[model samples]
Target: MSVEHDKALAAKGRHIALVIAATMLGWLAMSLFIGPALGLAGRYALLFDFAALAGFIYAAVNIFQLWRMRQDSQR
Candidate 1:
């Protein structure tokens, strides 16, 4: 493979890693802070709901990636 190809692949990998890490951290931070604060704000606020929705989205994404990795491994 060409040097350019290698550099591109590395760059792509780095980007993906950064995104995944950030999402994971965001989920963690929200769960720890905004989630509970919203929950304590009585039954009208949507902070907890937002956290739940974000958790589901991130979980789905991570699961999809895992499934894809499994598929690739099977090949």
Candidate 2:
């Protein structure tokens, strides 16, 4: 694979990782701190959890795609 292609893939992987990390941290903060501090409703907290799950799923799909690309390149 070309250097630029490799770099692009690496960048994408980094972006995906950052997104996953941020989503998890935000979810934790909301669940443990912000929600209670603000007296947010249980429904709102569940909504946030679902949003975080969606974000995680998105990251997982992208990571799988990137892995497939790398495998194809190896072939």
The most accurate candidate by lDDT is 2
| Candidate 1 C-alpha lDDT tens digits along 1-75 | 457655755665565566666766776666667757666554423554566567667656766665565466556
- Candidate 2 least-lDDT 10 residues: 65-74
Candidate 2 RMSD computed on C-alpha atoms after optimal superposition onto the true structure? 0.8
Candidate 2's residue-wise lDDT over 1-75, tens digit each? 999989989998999999999999999999889999999989989989998999999999999999998999899
Worst 10 residues of 1 by lDDT: 40-49
lDDT of 1: 0.61
Measured against the true structure, the TM-scores of the candidates, in listed sequence, are: 0.51, 0.94
